[model samples]
Target: MPRPVYLVDFSVYKPPDEMKMNYNQAYTLSRQWKECVDDNHEFISKVFQRSGISPTESYLPPWVNPATCKEPKYDMDSAKKEAEMVMGGAVADLLEKTGTRPDEIDILVTNCSIYCPTPSLCSLLVNKFKFRPETQTYHLGGMGCGNGVMALSLLRDLLQARPNVKALFVPAEIVTYCFYPGLQKDYMVANAIFRMGGAAILLSNQARYYSTAKYELLHNVRAHTGQDDGAYTCMGWGPDKKGVNGVYLRKDVPVQAAKALEVCLRRLAPSIITWGQYAEAARNLFERRVLGWQVPEYIPDFTKCIDHFALHAGGYAVLKGLMAAMRLPTEKMLPSFATLRDYGNTSCSTTWYVLGYMETCQGIGRGETVMQIGMGGGMKAGINVWRALREVKNVHPAWRHVAHAPVTEADLPRPINDPEAAAAAVPAGDIAAAVKASFGADFKATTAVAAH
Candidate 1:
């Protein structure tokens, strides 16, 4: 049998307070950029308000903050600095808390969808922290948000191949350069939701660290629907009609994501499901294939085996799509919703934020399993299965603001991710009332400064 891999610990970067951009600030920044193109204040304001993001949700890069600048600075230098702050801070925190030296890491894996600079982030960190020359460095760029668990998959394989070694994985997205300065509504969604965040995680295969490890890696699977043209073209980074660059999120994204989830789950089910579920699936397969029952494929009850879920916080619809398809309850979906409400969509780092919420707020008992599911622009889905070695309730700085009062279902925006809400024009007042009901006093206080 192959040696086991363990997650030593992980750190989520909490941006400095000055970088926190409330809803109104984000709207102001978006309006400033749209003024040159298609500035319809009322329409744009409605979009921001109804985006399923609350008043206190996202953090902006220093250059993109309305409080710090008149307009966002989207140049290469600013992008690099943004990377340094989020990624550098996360890595530093991991090293400091774990007491692990830079040179001690046998492998370094970094991922950033945009803003991959020359010499690469891996080399930049190696030089900055002085990792040994022989350290194995891998950088994944433009792979989209699923790269967080994808990195975990990569690290798992590497640890299985090489024993007695440590690896540092950093997943982040630099929203600075990705800021859309154009007028296209499809492209502007990126500006409204994508936020600044990153995470540094340490993994080890050494038996000596097993006792201190949080979880033991069980299985990692990744699947893509890129074979389908719709999936492949669902999301892209390119220039619009006006020749202005941005990430275009297509309407078909939710559909394609559901398909990708189906593909990933099909591959992952056999490994994680119970023998009873396996028997049921086998019977379903026989009926569908041999008997021609025209029945739907079996979806095993994941809650039966998996104790916790750290799902992707890509968007309200994305989470809902996954929830509906998988038949999960609102209680199991709280972590992802809370992450989206607190940090917006942090892209590749979203799953880490979700996991951090569970660690800080919902304790994971020993021997319990955690399944992290993530999907991103590639129309890809990644799943990581881990079995906790010890009970974990450690507080994380990323969740500090809400850790004291755990996020309940009442805290999330309602009338969200529903077809009726999507089809009809939801009165702005109704949406505001829903938000007010959800947040209560906190919503009133936050909206005092955020409301236009």
Candidate 2:
């Protein structure tokens, strides 16, 4: 297996803190589950109660939710309007920075848990940038939050076959549309959590690109736990039989995840970690009774060896689980939480968002390693490790976050460009330009994605 060094994670982003859009607004507007809605101003306290979580036991930090916990906040109108520009612009900017041409791309894969573009994001890239028409492409949907890691796994495997393939992968979610008017606890939970997120990664086995790439794939492990009762447990707010609800975040998410990760990691280790630590975890599990001293289900000590932590800006609890399980310090893990609090959980693209921030603000020095942890249904758990390349040839201009943080691209909307960008360009929403750019000015076709 070829090592996949981290090149550049361009999508790590966080919305401004003052952005007025929040879950409270959606919850209040949602007439469906008014009775179940808890609009208390108690901040994180109310969220814990709603989530049925005990911070003490859960390992959640004090500053996470602050005074208010709401669903993710992104200017949907603005995001949709600029989605094309942001995606294309960022890609263009990345290509320009890396000294790579748009046409050099050999592979493309995209996943949008909420929005599946007609022409598919990959197609848009092909047409807009003139990537080879034969580039392998994939559009993944309905995988929920886990889609991002799944995309990485897919990209890794594809790159293996096409060693020179410059796989440009994107994983994003538009939670704005997912907000349905319902206040059922499940509905409310979805409304309370889940946020807009998107991430992009450039992968290749080419030796030239490898030198600048951040981390390589030491290994990847994926599992599905939402097989039965876990299926609908953690879901997004959409048109369920009852009504529009955000994702249904379940009570069993963490516990179920613990079991799945253990199984997956057992297969990936040996080189990543010593057998002794693994043995400690195994012994602890057997000796610790079901009711004995609370043993954190995960051992992140190995992950700790990695310099940075790029956990999906998942809700506070998920980050805490990894922290407590591995005994990680609060300060060290702040980048992810900070990204989540400010960015509002940009869904699948979260870890990328953090990666961007780290590069600019904290500085992702060369040779530093980062661990990306992802979770979704089936109590699924996916882990992807990255080591920072010696240098980031390119950093997207729109990569800044917060006010003290500069995310000025808010006003610079993305216009549709490059139609024949992907193998097939669907001509709706954002694909109009991609097809027009790649295929031709006259390329006219209705956009259709893998999922509507």
Candidate 3:
């Protein structure tokens, strides 16, 4: 028999007011960037105005101050300090919530997309908390914001193979080193968002944990669109003209992400949707393929399958695209939007904040299903289906101080449709040429396979 994985408890890091950044404070900090002149500042302000992020969202690293506005120190010591601040808080809270000691964790997994030190995040936790030397530890890096669900999927598999063990998963992105002060518009956009946050989650297959567990891991589906040249470079860390390293997000990222999500949902729907919905989708596929009939695309009513959504709080455009593609109602999209508004894009940990919002505001009931979706730099989309095991009455510390303001579309910034909004110097033709040149014969065959 397979070991059933359950989420015993989870905690999200809440940065102090000292690190909070309002719209004016963000603009002030942007002025310190290398290429942020009056015009660039104005453009960035406009972008933030439409970014769906609230003015009161928190940014990170106690070192980031508008009054100082100095370039963040990206040394290893600073990185360690930032990790301690966020990860320590999250782990402490999670341990308290689960009533588990550090030594009780049989497996420890830590994910930080950009910062992986010699000791590794897992090792750091072990040293700080004094876990047993035999405890299993794994560190995941460069997997992007979707890594939280990816980590959960890995934990589920681990518990299945080794039953009756407790695991701790910490997902965070340290913004100190990732702060880009470059002239590249794409890279500078990251500076506008990408705040500091982290989440610590505890899972187990032990029978004792089941009664207190909040959710059960049901299914996880992942789709990687990196095979396509367009998806590969849509969002990634690269150097600018002046050799300043930073992450860049293409304007067409939402379009590329939608394509990837469509593929993932196609694979995921059959497992979660009702039998009737599955039959309809199967018929639609048969008609389009075997029957050679031009049939309309079949969209499963996901609301019937899942009661709550923990979509990634990536950005305004990304969330908008996902809401439209999945046919999610405004209320269903509120948690994601509200998370983005309050925390900005907390990278891998953003989905946890969304889940927290759902518990705090929407009130998920026992046995209700939730679909947690996330996308990241690998042009990867991940979905995790979870069923609530028990009704949670305790509010997470992160949501304790947050006001219960209802989210509305009006809270988000106005949408923009300028041609420049989608403009990029790296044309499609150039991307194709580069891919062909780099991969030679493999590029053509891979492109064909991806298209099929």
Backbone clashes counted, model 3: 0
As a whole number from 0 to 100, the lDDT of residue 54 in candidate 2 is: 19
lDDT of 2 by residue, 1-452 (tens): 55443343344323334333334443344223333334432322244332211122111111122223333233355334334543565566566656777667777776766555566656766777787777777877667666677567777777666655577876766554554454444334433444434556677777866565665666577877656575445444355557554455444444555555555655555446656676876677776765476754444365446677777655544454455444455555666655555454556776776666666656667676677766665456678777666754334333443324532222211111112223123222222122122222211111100001
* All candidates in order of TM-score, best leading: 1, 3, 2
Worst lDDT run of 10 residues, candidate 3, spans 443-452
Ranked by lDDT, top first: 1, 3, 2
Better of 1 and 2 by TM-score: 1
The candidate that achieves the highest lDDT relative to the unseen native structure = 1
lDDT by residue for model 1 over 1-452, one digit each (tens)?
Answer: 88898999999999988788777666556556534454544544545455456676578887877667786789999998998889999999999999999989999999998778999999889888899999999999888888898778778889989989999999999989888777776666676667889999999999987788999989888887788898898787889999998887665565566567667787888888899998998999999999999986676777897888888876665555456556566788898888887887788888899999999998899999999987776778788999999989989998887878998877776433444333123222222223223322222112211110
Q: Name the candidate, 1 or 3, with the larger lDDT value.
A: 1
lDDT of each: 0.77, 0.51, 0.74
Note the clash tally of each candidate: 0, 53, 0
Q: Which residue pairs collide, candidate 3?
A: none
Residues 286-334, model 3: lDDT tens digits: 9999999986667777888889899888665555445545666778888
The local lDDT score (0 to 100) that residue 312 gets in candidate 1 is 83
